[model samples]
Each structure stands twice: as C-alpha cells, then as structure tokens.
Target: MRVLIAPDKFAGTLTAVEAAQAMATGWLEQAPDDEVVTVPMSDGGPGFVDVLSAALGGELLAVTVTGSLGEPTPATVLLHEGTAYVETSQACGLDLVPPERRDPERATTYGVGELVAAALEAGARRLVLGLGGSGTNDAGAGLLAALGATAQPDGVLASGGAALAEVTALDLAPARARLAGVEILAASDVDNPLLGLRGATNVFGPQKGVAEERRVTLDAALERFADLADRSLADAKGAGAAGGLGYALSLLGGTRVPGIETISAAVGLPDRARAADLVLTGEGSFDFQSAGGKVVSGVASVAGEAIRPCLVLAGQVLVGIREMRTMGVESGYSLVDLVGRERALGAPRDSLVELARRVARTWSR
Candidate 1:
C-alpha cells in the first residue's frame, strides 16, 4: 500500500515536514511492507516559507529585521529564481510575543518591510508574502514606515495601532517606488475587511490581548490610518488578515490569494496524492473550524477527488465522527483519546508516532 502523509504544522509543536516524517516513521515501524510518501503542507501561515523552501529547493536568504516590538530579529526568506517567499510570521508571529505581553495595540509589523527590502536587494521582482499568525492591529503602518513612509513627528509610525490616530502626513511615493516593478501577492488566511464588526480590530484583536476597553480605541486608530493611508482598501477582502498587514500591501497594489490553494499548486499536492492508496492529514486540533479553509480540509478534498481513503490524526479531536465522514475522512484519532491531555500536550511527538503505528496496524495490509 502507498500512504501519502501531508499535514499542516501542529501549531507550536511541530512543522508540517516534521509531522509528516514522524507519521511515516511510526507507520513504517508497524507496516514495513508499505510505501510512504511525505508532503509537508501549509496554508500560507507560519510554516509557509519552510515548507515551500524544502519542496521548491529555494535558497534561504538571511537578513535582520525589526521584530513585532522593535527588537532586532533575525529572519530568512526563500528565494526561487526571482520569486521570493516571505512569511510574516518570521517577524511578527504571535508566538514571538510572550503570553503575558501579547498586546495587539502595541505590536507592529515593521520587520515585514525589512524582509521585503532584503528580497528587493537580492533582485527579487516577484514577492509572495504569507500573511497570518500576526501579533498586531496596526493596519500595516509599521510595514509602510519600514518601506520609506515617513512617520509622524510624535513617533506615531513605530507605535502600534493606537498611535495611528496621531498620523500627521503621508509620503507613499518612496514606498511605491520601491515596489514599482515588483508583483506582490499576499496569501491570506482570512477575508475580513479592514473596518467594521468583521474587521481586523473587532474580529482578531481579542486573540492578541485586546479587550472591550481597548477595542474601540484600536478600531478607531485603524480607521484613522486607513483613511489617511488608503481609503480605497478600507473594505477590501483580506484587508483584516495578519492584523491588517494585508491592507497595507493592498495599498501598494498587492493582490490577495487563498493561501491553501496557492500552496497546493506550488507543491503539486493533488497530483502527488492521486496515486496514493491512503492519505493521512492532520493538525494540532481537529474541530469544527477544521471544516473551513485549513490545510487538513484542503488535503482531504484532494484525496476525496482521487477516490482515496483519507484518515486524520489530531492532538485533540472535537468534531464528531459523522462530520469526519462528511469531510471524506474514513476515520479520525486524537492523541488526547489514546493518552491523557497532559501527556498529549507534554509529549506530542511520541504520542503522534504511537497513534500512527496503531493506525497502520489496524488498517494497513
């Protein structure tokens, strides 16, 4: 039997490649006669650069950029020919900020601009930016500032979203000049607009530690910046992605693309999974949200089209079996079911391997 293992990163625990490898190792340990093919997958988020770099054999270029909080951050971009893959998580990922210090009003995406600058310097005219897992709600103010947009005399640019209300002037000529010949594609996980109830500040602010008391303030700031910077993209699709970094890019002629589809095409996932007898895909947690536009959902759809059996192995399973069946997954397993929650969280790799071995033993001939 040929088994294709393609899964997204397990959030903070494992990369997509590492997860695929672990599942393959465990499956082979039990079913030695079976063939396993691994394909790491991402939805243009944290693992975007790493997965594409490995699959496309792109060169990784290192550069120093500003962090979410103005700290010096070492980052790398994947360059394949003239196309550059830049993951915003490399600079302003929520994981980079501590649990206690996560402040949507304070975090900035200045480092993204620095990375783009580095890619431009390296002769890249095609830029694909992965925009997700951000820790800011500045509507890309920091990014524009880094790309040569002048800041307010009162230091408004470096500050987070709340400071956007103090914007005194705008100078986008330099920033637009830098990206004149470049084609920018921002892969987004969400399609919310820049302002309103479904906007960045209201929908995503809480996850980054913005509370009711501060929500109105940040929303107003983003609105202020949107009006001052680019009122055209205020209601654009994906403008809310990555705490409004998508909005910033949209202001500079950046197009928004669905992340999973872009990645699937780049890695040729459908063609690879077509010949496999079974496909196993998963994530950190499998829940109702998994039915939406996620890596697991994308993988399952591909497998379904090929008439192949698809199974899922998750860290914590919340969706029901009928729901799994509807998604074309023959069955599903969660580490939390085999092992306790504590053990699953504390030792995920071991639990994942054990689960894979069990699945192979039960189903693989």
Candidate 2:
C-alpha cells in the first residue's frame, strides 16, 4: 500500500514540514510494509518560502527590512532563476507581534516593500509575493511609500491604516516607474475587497486586534486611501488580502493567482495523488474554512480527481461527518480528540504522531 501525506502548518505548534514528517514517521511505524510519501503544503501563508524553496531548488537571499512596528526585521527572498518569491508574513506576520502588543491600526507593511526592493536589486524581473497572515491593516500604504509613492503631507501616510484617513493626495508615478517591465504575481486565496462589510477592515480587523467600535472608522480610512489611489481596484477580489497588500500590488500591476492552485501546480500534486493508493492531508483545524481555498481542500480535490480516498488528520476537527464528506474526505481525526487538549497543546508533535499511528492501523491494508 502507498500513502501520500500532505499537511499545512498546525498554527504555532508545527510547520507543514514538521507535521508531514511526524505523520510519515507514525504511519511507517504502524505499517512498515506500506510506502509513505510526504509533501508539505502551504496556502501562501507563513511557510510559503520554506515550502517552495524545498520543492524548487533556489537561493534563499537574506535581507533586513522594517517590521510592522518600525523595527528592523530579518527576511528572505527565494531567488529561483530570475524570479523572486517573497512571503508577506516574513515581514509583518501576526506571530511577529505578541498578543498584548498587537495594534492593527498602527501596524505597517513597509518591510514588505523593502523585501520587494531587495528582490529587484537582486536582478529579479519576475516577482511572486505570497500574501496572508499579516499583522497590518494599512492597505499597502507603507509598501507604496517604500516604492517611491509620496503623500502630500509627508508623514500623514507614513504608517498604519489610521494614518490613511489624513492623507490629502498621493503621487504614484515614481512607484509605477520603478516596477516597469516587471511581472508581479500576488499569490493569495482571500477574495474580500478592500472596503465595506466584507472588506479588509470589517472582516479581518478583529483578528489583528482592531476594536469592534473602530471597524467603521478604519474601513473609512482605507476607503479614503483608495479614493486618492485607485478606487476601482478596491472592489476587486483579493483586494482585502494581507491588509490590502493585494490591492497595492494590483496598483503596481500585479496579477492575482490562487495560492493553493499556484502551489499545487508547482508541486504537481495531481500526479502525486494519482500515483498514490491513499491520500492524507490536514491543517490546524478542520472546519468550514478548511473547505475554502485551504491546503486540505486543495489536496482533497487532487485526491478526488485521482479517484483516491482522502483522509484528514488535524489538530482539531470542528466539522461534522457530513461536512467531511462534502470536502471529499473519507474520514477525519483530531489530535485534541484522541489525546486531551493539554497534550495536544503541550506536546503537539507526540500527540499528532500517536494519532497518525492509530489512524494508520485502520487505514493501512
């Protein structure tokens, strides 16, 4: 029997690579005769660079850039041929900031712009930016600023989403000039626009520590920036991604690509699934969101295309059996359910390994 194992990062406990290895180790231990293939996956979030670098041999260029809080942060750009792959989360990821110190209104994406600049300086003519899991809500104001766009009052649009409310005008001519003749790909799965109820501020602000009362104000601020920049692109799909970094990339003429699809094609997941007897994929939580543009859903789709049975082994399974069926998953298991919450949280690696060992006994033939 042959088994294909693929998984996304289990939030803070483990990266996709770590999760895949743990699952493989447990599966092999339980069924030593079975063939196990591990493929770590990501949905253009935190582990985007590392995953792509492992799959596609590339030079990981190290660079220092400004972080979300005006501090120097170290980041990397994967240079494969003339294309540079940049991960947004590397610069201003929410994990970079502590929970108590999180302030979405004041966070900045200036470091992301610096990362782009570094890529360009390294002679990259094509840039693919992986966008998600950001700590800012600045709508890419700081990014544009780093690329040579200027606010009328200088410091009025220096940083953060709240500062956009005070902007009187912006000049994007210089930024446009700098990105000329470059192909930019915005890799993300989020479809929300940049403003309104379904937009960046209303839908994602709360997660970044935006107060309930400040949603409308921040949304209006982004609107104000869009009004001065490009109002038309504000309603475009994925404009809300990475705190409107998608929209800013659009302003710079970046084409949007579904992150899962991009990674799938790059890794040739369909062919791998077709060759495997059973397919297994997972994430931190198997919930309704897991069915939408996530690694688990993408892997399940690939497995379904190959007429193979797909299973999920996640940290927690929050969806019902019906939902699992809808997701094309034969069954699902959770580490938290198999072991207690304490073990799942405190010893995630061991708990996941034990869960995989148990599941392998039933699934492996």
Candidate 3:
C-alpha cells in the first residue's frame, strides 16, 4: 500500500515538513512494507515560501527588512523562472512577536514592502505574495509608506494603525511607479474586508491582542486610512488578509488567488492524491475552521476529487466524525486524545509519532 502524507504547520509546535517527517517515521515503523510520500502543505501562511521552495526547487534570495515591531528582520524570497514568491508572515507574522509584547495597535507591515522592493531589485517580473498569520493591524499603511506612498506633511503615516487617523492625504504614485508592469498575485484564504464587523480588526484583532474596547478605535483608524487611500478596495475579498496588506496590494493592482489553490496546483496535489491508496493531511487543530480554506480542507478536497480515502492526523481534533466526513475526511485522529494535553504540548513531535504509529496499526495493511 502507498500512503501520501501532507500537513500544515502545527502553529507554534512544529513546521509542516517536520510534521510530515514525524508521521512518516511512525507510519513506516508500524507498516514497514508500505510506501510513504510526503508533501508538506500551507495555506498562504508562515511556511508558504518553504513549501513552495521544496516543490519548485527555486533560488532563495535572503533579505533583511523591518519587522512588525520596527526592528531589523531577516526573510527570504523564492525566485523561480522570473517569478518571486513572498511570504508575508516572515515579515509581520504574529509568531514574530512575543505574547507579552504583542501590540496590534502599533505593529506594522513595513517589512513586507521592503521584501517586495528586494524582490523587484532581484529582477522579478511577476510577484506572488502569500498573506496570512500577520501580527499587525495597520491596514497596510506602513507597507505603503515603505513603498514610497507619502502623506501630505510627510511622516504622518510613519507609525502603525495608530497614526492612520492623522493622515490628511496620500500619494500612491511613487509606489505605483515602482510596481508598474509587475504582475502581482495576492495569495490568501481569508475573505474578510478591511474594516467593519466582518473585517480585519473585528475578526482577527483579538488574537493579536486588540482588546474588545480597542477594536472599535483601531477599526476606525483603518477606516481613516482607507478613506485617504482607496476606500473602494477596502471591502474587497481578502482585503483584511495580513492586516489589510491585501488591500494595499489591490491598490498596487494585485490579483487575488486562494492561497491553498496556488500552493496546491504548484505542488500537483491532485495528481499525487490520485496515485496514492490513502491520503493523510492535518494541522494544529482540526475544528470547524478546518473545513474552511485551510490546509486540511484543501488537501481533503483534492483527495475527494481523486476518489481517494482521506484521513486527518492532527494535534487535537475538535470536530465530530460527521463533521469530519462532511469535510471529506474518512476519519480523524488526535495527538491530544492519544496522549494527555501536557505531553501533547510538551513533546508534540513524539506525541504525533506515537499517534501515527497507533493509527497505522489499524489502517495499514
């Protein structure tokens, strides 16, 4: 029997590649006669560049840029066949900031702009930017500023979302000039707009430390920035991704593509699933949100299209078996369920290995 293993990053615990390796190790231990193939996955988040590089064997260009907290940060841009792939999380992801230091009110996307500038300087004619897992909520004001979009008095947009309310006017011509003729793909799975109830601040701000009371103020600041920038694109799909970096990309004429679809097609997941006897995919938590445009659902969909049996091996499985079937998964196994929560969190890789080994006993022939 042949098994194809694909999984996304386990949030803070393990990377996608690491998770795949752990699963493969345990599966092979239990079923030595079976063949296992690994294809790590991402949904336009932190591991976007790494996964793409693994698939495309691209040249990684290292660059230093401003981090979400206005500090120097290191990131990589994957250049392949004149197209550059940029992962937004490397520059401004929530993982970059410590929990005690997390401040969505002041975080910025300036590093993302610097990354794009570096990619352009490397002679990339087409840019594919993966957006997700950001820490900032500046509505991309800092990114625009880094890309040469200036305010009337200058330095008005220097700060993050907190300063957007003070902006009187914006000049986007310079940024447009820099990106002219560059085909940009804004990759993301989020569909929330830039502001309002279903928008960036109201929906994602809490996770990044935007208190309930401060959400309204921060959302209004984004509204002000949008008013000065382009209000029309503020309500566009994925505009809220990476804390409104999607909207800024729209202002620069970037086309939106679902992050999963972009990465899935690039990796040829459908064909791989078709060739496999069993398909395995997972994430940090397999909950209701897993059915959304996340990595697990994306992989399950591809397996379903190929008429293959898809199962999930996650750190924790919150959804019921019925919901798992609805998401195209035959069954779901949880690390937390096999081992206690303490061990699951302390030794995630080992816990997953044991869980996979146990599951293999029942599933593998």
Candidate 4:
C-alpha cells in the first residue's frame, strides 16, 4: 500500500515534519514492506515558516526582533531568491508571552515589523506575511509604528478593542511611503470578518486574554478603526485574523490569499496526494476550525475531490465521527484519546510513535 503521511504540527509537542517522521517510522517498523511517504503541513499558523521552508527549498534566516511583549527575541524568516516568507506568529505569537503576561491589549506586533524591515534590508522584492497565532489586537498599529509610521491622534487608533471607542482619525501617509514599492501578500486561512459576533474581536479576543466584558469594547474600537481607515471591514473575509492585522494589511495595499493554497502550491501537495493510495493528514486539534479552511481540511477537500482516502491522526479530535466522515476522512483518531490525556500531553513523541505503530500493525494485518 502506498501511504502518504502528511500532518500539521502538534502545537506544543511536535512540528509537522517531526510528526510525519514519527508516524512514518512507526508504520515502517510494523509494515516493513509497505511504502510510506511523508509530507509535513501547516495552516498558516505558528509552524508555517518551517514547513514551507523545508518543502520549498528555502533557507531559514534568523534575525533579532522584538517579542510580542517588547522583549528581545531571536526570530526566523524564510527566504528564497527575492521573496521572503514571514510568519507573523514568530514575533507576535501568544506562545511568546508568559501565561501571567498574556494581555492582548498591551501586546504588540513590533517584532513583526522588525522582521519585515530586516527582510526588506536583505533586498527582498516581495514579502508574504502569514497571520495567525498572534497575541496582539493592535490592528498592526505596532507594526506600522516599528516601521516609522505614526498613528494620527484623531484617526481610528485604539489600544486593543476598548480603546477603539476613542478612535477618530487614521494616518497612513508614512506607512504608504515606506511600503511604496514593496509587494505585500497577507496569507491567511480564516474567513472571519473585522467586526461583529464572527469578527476578530468577538471570536479571537478571549483567547488572547480579553475579558468577557471587554470583548464588546474591543470590537467597537476595531469598528471605528476600520471606518476611519475607509476600508470595508464589515463582512470582509479573513479580516478577523491576527487581531485585525488582515484588515490593516488590506489597507496597506496587501493582497489577502488563502494560506493553504500558497503553501500547497509551494510544496506541490495536490500532485503528490493524487499519486498516493492513501493520504494521511492531521493537526494539533480537529474541529469546526479545521473544516473552516485549515490545512488539514484543505488537504481533505482536495483529496476528497480526487477520490482519495484521507486519514487523520490529530493531537485532539473534537469533531464527531459523522462530521469528519462528511469531510471525506476515512478515519479520525486522536493521540490524546489513544494514549490518555496526560501521556499524550506530556510525552507526545513517544505516545504518538507507539500509537502510530499499533495502528500500522492493524492495517498491516
């Protein structure tokens, strides 16, 4: 049997490449005669840069950039020829902040700006910025600040969402000039809008440490900022991603595109999946979000149309079997359930390999 092992990063535990390796190793150990191929995947989140770099033959370039909390941190950007791939999460990810300091209101995207500046200094003619896993709700204001763009006091400038209520004006002249000749691409996987229940503040604010009562305030603030910027933030797909960074990018002449499409094209996933007898895809968690445009769902969508069997092995599987089946996933398994929550969460590598080996043994029979 020809099996394709394509899995996303297991969040805190393993990278997509590492997960694929573990699964491949386990499968090979149980079925030595079977053919297994490994393909790592990401959904334009934290591991996007690494996965894309490995698949696209790009070099990982390390640069010193400010952290989400304004601390000095060493971040990496992927570069190939005149194009640089920047995963904004590297500099502004929630994981970068300590639990006690997880305040989305105070967090900033300055580090992302620093990375972009460094890439531009390196002579990159084009830049693709992946937006996800961010800890800030500055709407890319901090990013512009780092790039020497100042926010107008009367323009829709807000700190987090609550502050948006105070926004009345916007300043983009400096930013426009700075980014004049640069082509900016905002690669995102979400379709959520800028404001409302399904918007950035309402859906993602809580996770970024916004208090329950503060959500509305933040949402309103983002609304005002969107209005002053003269951009139609309402119902704009992907405008909710990265704390309204997508909207900010749109205002800055950045084109928004699906992250999976870009990564798949770069890695040649569609062609490879077509040739495989079985395609395996997964992520840290599989639920409505997975079906809502994540890499695993994207892979499943493509594989389904091609009449290929796709299996999923996630760190945690929250979706019901029926839902996953409808998505064309032949089978779905969770490492957490298979190995117990503690073991799966604590020593994921060993547990995942063992589980994969057992599963492979069953299939071999």
Q: Which ten residues in a row have the lowest lDDT in candidate 3?
A: 152-161
RMSD to the native, candidate 2? Answer: 1.2
lDDT of 3 by residue, 284-328 (tens): 999999877999999999999999999999889999989999989
Candidate 1 lDDT over 21-90, as tens digits, reads: 8899999999999999988989888999999987899799999899998889989999998999999989
- What TM-score would each prediction reach against the true structure? 0.96, 0.97, 0.97, 0.91
- Badly placed stretches (over 4 Å) of model 4 are 153-169, 233-235, 362-365
List, in order, the clash count of every candidate structure.
Answer: 0, 0, 0, 7
**17-135 per-residue lDDT for model 2 (tens digits):** 99999999999999999999888989999999988887787899999999999889999999998999999999999999999999899999999999999999999999999999999
Query: So what's the TM-score on candidate 1?
Result: 0.96
Q: How big is the positional error of residue 365 in model 1, measured in Å on the Cα after superposition?
A: 2.5
Residue 64 deviation, candidate 3, in Å? Answer: 1.1
What's the residue-level lDDT of 214 in candidate 4? 83
Ranking by lDDT: 2, 3, 1, 4
